[model samples]
Target: MSFRDEVEDGRGDLRKPFLHTGSWYRMGSRQSSIMGSSQVIRDSSISVLACVLIVALGPIQFGFTSGYSSPTQSALSKDLDLTVSQFSLFGSLSNVGAMVGAIASGQIAEYIGRKGSLMIAAIPNIIGWLAISFARDFSFLYMGRLLEGFGVGIISYTVPVYIAEIAPQNLRGGLGSANQLSVTIGIMLAYLLGLFCSWRVLAVLGILPCLILIPGLFFIPESPRWLAKMGMMDDFEASLQVLRGFDTDITLEVNEIKRSVASTSRRTTIRFADLKVRRYWLPLMIGIGLLVLQQLAGTNGVIFYSTTIFESAGISSSNAATVGVGAIQVFATAVSTWLVDRTGRRILLIVSSFGMALSLLVVAIAFFLKGFVAEDSSLYGIFGILSVVGVVCMIVSFSLGMGPIPWLIMSEILPPKIKGLAGSVATLANWFSSWLITMTAPLLLAWSSGGTFSLYTVVCIFTVAFVAIWVPETKGKTLEEIQHSFR
Candidate 1:
């Protein structure tokens, strides 16, 4: 079904997801009252812990589903008696399903709060894992995989937004970075576990995160920003109070959120036509641009064909190389989580994009050298090692910034009203680019591995320039402050 159909709320009405326009923060209009800083520090630490724990599950599930098929590929093919072409389709179907989910996610999050959207996503994931575990036919397997993909697509948009909204300004970037860390961790878990478990058991493991999240949702507060936007004043205040701590003197914050919400109340339904305004379109471009460049930088090209890349690098154990890649991703993302708050988003992105570019250039050079050297020569061996180093560098460089920052910035920059629409568009563009890059990667590799990476190198270089020129430092600003900074 189309997203229009999916967006129909339980009340049988299509709730238009609104985009907030103009500078609504209007700080002068709000009153300020200071709460005891020490009291707030003491209480809010525990307050948001549950929220982080729960929301992080979505990313873990994303990683798990992504890493699941890697080790299970042969078993899936053998058991289903699938041809290479059919197996390739099975592997990529998640992207197709993800595109659908990405399109529908904004509206889903709009109708339901961020928490509710996550809860909705969890159902599909749980059911998908169960179906995958129990499947006796290809149809069940396909449906299960698609459902898991759809769930993650929804999770992809919702988790970062949720974290950004609820997190204190000082901690937003670091917390947002956690989402990517969870993704890497989930991927590592799947890869490590897939070695010991059967495909069915691994599928069952995929269900566990959602199982934890389903119950955990109840214990956390919804996004106060979303609550206020819906004009649910009581719940809004309650959620914010809970997030900040009960006695954290939320008067100033409450007034700020109320004013933003009050301004948004008038523009409750965003039509496709409404995006014509420069305000809406500008952020859309930024969000979509980052996502596209993130893909065009060819992170997926490396990921989908890491084994081939390792072999081409003259690595004897392709599996070990792939495992090393996953390990680096997890480590780099952990470092990103620490660095994001300190360095801010823009610098990290510029650095990441540039680093990846240089890394890709090295790989291109190594491959170019490989073409010239005899396979038995010591020079070829050196080039082979260089290729492996370049591959690791590329993955590390990507994990540091490009992997997490685009979604973080997208969540931070878009006003709540337009977040659903713009986020959906950006995410859809991401999935489409992923599909395009994945589809053409083998041909590109065949035509020239050096040339393929050179193309990505150019894109990565452009990404650095883009970040330097266009992306803002969203390090410690309130959501309202960050959105208005774009103005």
Candidate 2:
């Protein structure tokens, strides 16, 4: 007998969604959400990789928007003759657009299916980039940034959920992690290109991924789990076979999917109120909590203010330190992708949380000492080195787990019935926390850099406990198995 046989009794628990939760949430309400999956013959791994890569482009676009202003800040400001206050608003409008996008993403993805949603998201991004490329005024830049941010917001939720739904259990962790990897790559590439290209040329380049993604969507299979949820059994099976390889036996997988679907209550509409159940609420809390902790770890505060921190620590070239931190984040996140499947999710999260706490404490101490010592004291040199080390260590710890794992786990554990709603809420919380941290970072640093990092240290320590106690290992589990563990 398979694991399903032994766990048959628990199917009753899964059925709660269909009987109650689905009713309130309008589950499976849209049949025409997306076109039918295309017939294709290919290895399962190739199909999965191809799909992930295509979807991953959205994140690259997201990163480009994020990194664009940093390198071109002076040039753009000078060319546009904008005030610091105006430029500040221009910088921040993206978060506003993202929050709006987060709230709408669930409804959009659910109504149109993941592929259709990506198509919708692409339109605005292309238009947004064009607006930026052709802009002659500050308002144009503002509108363009807002549009791109909104598009990225939608893509953020869809890509991970799409990847989670399509990836085979064995490859899920690594592939899911690719979303973060792509974002980092985009940021790095943007920074590198900004060195040579004019800001307008760079803005035009932002259109590249969306251009590729629009056509690329046609080649990949629609998510099989999505097909199964929509009650299209034939298409569901066909999609699964394409993902698993044309010649592979899908009988065992099909039975498991059938059992998984059967376990859910399929007789009702979806409802937001359905979240009162332990099954749904538990995973929702975990996803949102991790996102909260990820932000409160003060990663953004450090990123936003790293140059200043280095300057305070007595470094002559703060920009070099900032760039070094970015490189560390990209490298650490890259290593994480390889280790996620091999080492498992829970362990990495725990290690990451505690490691960050420890690193922040070092910086906190360094900053605390900066005030009392004489400027030319020997300790000043030591403290400067400590700050750099602390900041880099924090970046390494974060990139290893907290940075990517929250997004990966968020994509994995939520049931399809509540994925859009729950995912949107979680994504919103993440951006909210990011905005909060970035906005307040300078304030906190001015008040007391030590105090700010100390607060972050406390949060990271709490995260270590939270993950160790609540986060389950999700390395090799299917999406169904992951949701099951939440109970």
Candidate 3:
């Protein structure tokens, strides 16, 4: 029988008829209706609250490291006697590690299961934090940061997939946004801790969340969808029972799983070969384009060099400048979470890019004007105020656009069969672009601050064009629905 006919007839295991070949498949139409009713009941069992708690644990670590690293850069540079080049190398090295981790973790998640991978990812993350807190040398600090990046990369790629797989179709967007929200909260917490306490103390404190998360692993069930793929039908049903909360139509779930596995089995594992095809090329380009745009908008440049930006604006005190930048990032990201779902991804990208382009223009103008100013106090004051406004506008624009959308889109787009691989590629692109941006910003600043902002303005314009051409509206689609879009 055809796939559609089987589906309509309630013969859910159409692809793998043997899996349900026993008495289970012989049940009458009444039995099918009862099973369908049970699935509806089972669907009601999945708790949004539990899923939120599990997903939030991973992003907290991401936010803590991303936000806290900026404030510590000055201290690290001074303590390690880093020249400008060496300091830039530090940022590049972390992204290198993240790129490696993102690629490796996809295969790792397939083998170990998402929860297992999450548990393992946290161990290195906790250790990395502890190492940074006590590091006495540049190499030690670099190693610690590298490990932390690896952990972040793994969690970043995995947690969204896990949450998306487990969440009810209706709630996935909010839960997905929760991951972003937790990251913001973590950023805010790290910023607050860095402001009030020692960097070492804040680094050590960052590891505490892992302690809470490690225990959660035991309670949360594996993705029922994953179990179905393994041909462990019994375990798959059991997982669905626990996750969904009632007995489900195992046949329907199994059929969906069979279709997924059948489709995936036809292709080789993630490789360069996968990108050689016309069908895959567009998605790959879109993924990489988003990554490049995200970095070119100067989000990481701002994040890593926020202190320097603030100081250049005439905040002479180093500590206060770092704290101020951190505060701005925290508040901006918090606002992003609220606006992301409501504004839709495309509109936010367009509006924010416009804002960023305008902000960069202002900065370039301010710097150019500063060069012509005589040693007049009023001129200096005016230049400083303009510079501060420029930086604030840039931060707000970035938080709204580049900061959240890449992650959100990466998690949502692409077929499930290639999600792990596609996500890795996108994430790798993100980290590598971030590395280049961070590594070059200091040199760019020193060479020609006005020229640096001008370059970013140009890139932001390209970002606007790319979004208009390639990005699809994924604002309210289910995972199954999203996969169908690519098909």
Candidate 4:
């Protein structure tokens, strides 16, 4: 009569089914009765807040790296006596570090708990920030950037997994949005700090969250799913008790865990060869393709080089232009917090791609006509407006699809056994694509600004086409349900 019994009885369609568990329902019950009906809501609420705070900390590091580097790239270039090519190398190398870190962190997380993995990630972040604050030469600065990139990669891969594992099925989308929200807020904070103070001061401030939050992490509980995977049944039940918040049948929960774990354990060890199977390969392709599409839309190019883009478009104050672009990014992501669950992934991606293509086309036209408008104030005004539109479009587009969903989808798509490896591969793809785009932006700018924007516009068109054909609808699907789709 329990939920697990019903599943075993084949009483309902397993395909596209939503299991009511955790704090939401009791087993053998047709109605969605609250588990431990009195206190379940209270405990789940507290647990979610804790997860949000911890996950949000990881994103501040990402925001610091993504936002701080751009406005100060020119300053660092001047101070370090470096050429444009060196700056590009700096960006690419950071991505290289990120690529390594993401892969390593997955195994670490699997060995330790998600909370412990995140705490470990925070160490390099704090060190990176401290090093950047006092970096005296290009080499030291490059080292700091690499360290920061490594920390970001770890945090990015681990935090979403933690959130997904801990969050209740009904609230997953909203909680997942917190991760993106934090990143946007972090970016906004970094830009504001960079605007008002020296880059060193901004870098120094970046270390504060790591210092303040490290102690708080100890009080948090390990993920129930992770505990189950480790065969820590007592700890898993205890963790679930805290998470679920009510007196409920532990039997159903334990059985569900056993079913999932059994399924995973029967699978072969994840070799690169595992990805050759269609069941594994399809999700991996989706993950990598999403990252590639994100970069090809030139989101990072516009964000990291917004000042240069604005200057080329005739903006006078590079600092002011970059700040404006940063503000647009924050606002657009904030809007996405509301839009993502409501609008669904595919719609947002399609809309964003078209919007980006249109904005880039306008920017390309402005760049192509630069000679004719050299002295025209009206043309400058028009160009500035279009640049702002482009930035807004990029932010909105990215937040809705590329910014948050890639990680969210990747976390859910793979089976638990391969989750760590698959997540690492997907994240590596993300960093590599980021490196490719960031490293190429400056060269592309120097070669032909109009041509670069046009190229991105073309890429966006192809991305839209691909999304329509290949990406499955993951909206409202449970982690297990998502994986089942591929099979």
Question: Number of the top candidate by TM-score?
Answer: 1
TM-score of each: 0.90, 0.88, 0.82, 0.86
| Per-residue lDDT of 89 in model 1 | 73
Clashes of each: 4, 10, 0, 0
What is the C-alpha lDDT profile of model 2 across 359-405, one tens digit per residue?
Answer: 99999999899778887899879988998899999989998999889
Which pairs of residues have clashing backbones in candidate 3?
A: none
**lDDT string, candidate 3, 1-487, tens digits:** 5444665798644233111211232232126366463343344334544755865788898888777766666676787688766766665666777788888776666656777778778888898888878988778777877888898888877787777777655555556656766776777677667767777888899898788888876666676665555444555555555455543454664565566655564222556566566666666677678877888777678766767777776767755665565577667766776776677778887888888999999998898788877646788769877987898788778877676676667666756556667777777887778778877888898898899999999999888888888887777665556666766
Better of 1 and 2 by TM-score: 1
Segments of candidate 1 deviating more than 4 angstroms: 1-42, 266-268
Residue 349, candidate 1: Cα error in Å is 0.4
| C-alpha-based local distance difference test score of model 1 | 0.82
TM-score of 4: 0.86
- C-alpha local distance difference test of each model: 0.82, 0.80, 0.70, 0.72
- Model 4 backbone overlap count: 0
Model 4, runs deviating above 4 Å = 1-43, 74-87, 247-254, 266-269, 371-374
Q: lDDT (0-100) at residue 26 of candidate 3? A: 25
TM-score of 1: 0.90
